[model samples]
Target: MYNLPGLTIRTISVSETNNNVYILTSKTSGAQVLIDAADDAPAILSLLADAQEDTDATTHVSAIITTHSHWDHVRALGEVKEVTKAPTAAGEDEIEAITVPTDIALGHGEVRSFEDIELEVIQLRGHTLGSIALLYRDPRGPAHLFSGDSLFPGGVGNTEDDPDRFLSLITDVTERIFDQLPDSTVVHPGHGNGTTLGAERPHLAQWKARGW
Candidate 1:
């Protein structure tokens, strides 16, 4: 659990793929936004319930945002949406590939607000045509990014052997993310532990040179 002045962020690892389902709740209004329904409906539902309990307020998920349309990232999307009845949002280009219905089509620089907290959507291509990362800026501290699988501790998201895709992802990540945000920014990816921009900054050239 990560507590900011106006928000509470929790990550639940679900399914065999170890997909991360993040629940972001506005401390003032108890409005929540869930990122990635990943898998295991029962586990996802339990996480939602636990968040409500922990907050001690009537919490409701305003929307469920998908990072991309990968199967492992959306296995429980339908179930979670049906149970919560919250609208779903994803990158506009992903609408065709997604398995679940989308209520909102997000694009680069679009802002999604949950009560007083706002998340800026960044469209990052390569991992998928419409892969996105959400940037959350707290008034009192460093910003946070939910990078999905587009970023991780060791390197950027997997782009396979496609040099073009790797270049595209790295370019966007460098400009839209690394260059725009402070090094102190906290990056919470789709899986595993979190890392900071400063921690990964030095390795950018290495990642590019290696062509991963």
Candidate 2:
């Protein structure tokens, strides 16, 4: 659980892959955005229900955003959306590859907002052409990034040994993320524990040198 001034983030790990499904709820309005319905609708629904705890706010998911088109990342997309019926969104280039239809085709630099919540889309090309990470800059605290598979604790996501893909991904993550955001930024990745930009920033050169 990550609590900010007006926003609360909850994560559930599901499937054999240990995919982290995130639920971001506005503390006041309860307008929510479900990020990566990785697996298990029952688990995802329970996470949503838990969002209303300790408050009278009526929690409802406004949108479902998939960070990329990878199968493991979107295993539960169909069921979750079928039940919640929330509009789905994905990066423009990866939308067609997703199993479920995406209602919002997000381009780079678009701010996806709902009531008091706003998430800026940062295109992280390479892991997938349309791979992306969402940035939530809290008004009262450090920023949070939903990095998906494009970034992890040690390095960028896999590029299948393709130099071009790796370069594209690392470059975007460097310029668009590391360069623009603060070191206090907390990264919530898709399949593992979180990390701070401050912790990983020092290894940027190492990752580039290792070519992974």
Candidate number achieving the greatest TM-score relative to the actual structure: 2
Q: Which candidate number would show the highest lDDT if scored against the true structure?
A: 2
How many collisions per candidate?
Answer: 0, 0
Error of 1 at 141 (Å): 0.9
What is the overall TM-score of model 2 with all chains considered together? Answer: 0.98
Stretches of candidate 1 above 4 Å error?
54-56
TM-score of each: 0.97, 0.98
Looking at model 2, the pairs that clash are none
For model 1 the local lDDT of residue 195 reads 98
* Model 2: per-residue Cα lDDT over 67-133, one tens digit each: 9988888888999898888999999999989989999999999997877789999999999999989
lDDT of model 1 at residue 143? Answer: 95
Estimate, for each residue in 156-193, the C-alpha lDDT of model 1 and write its tens digit.
99998899999999999998999999999999999888
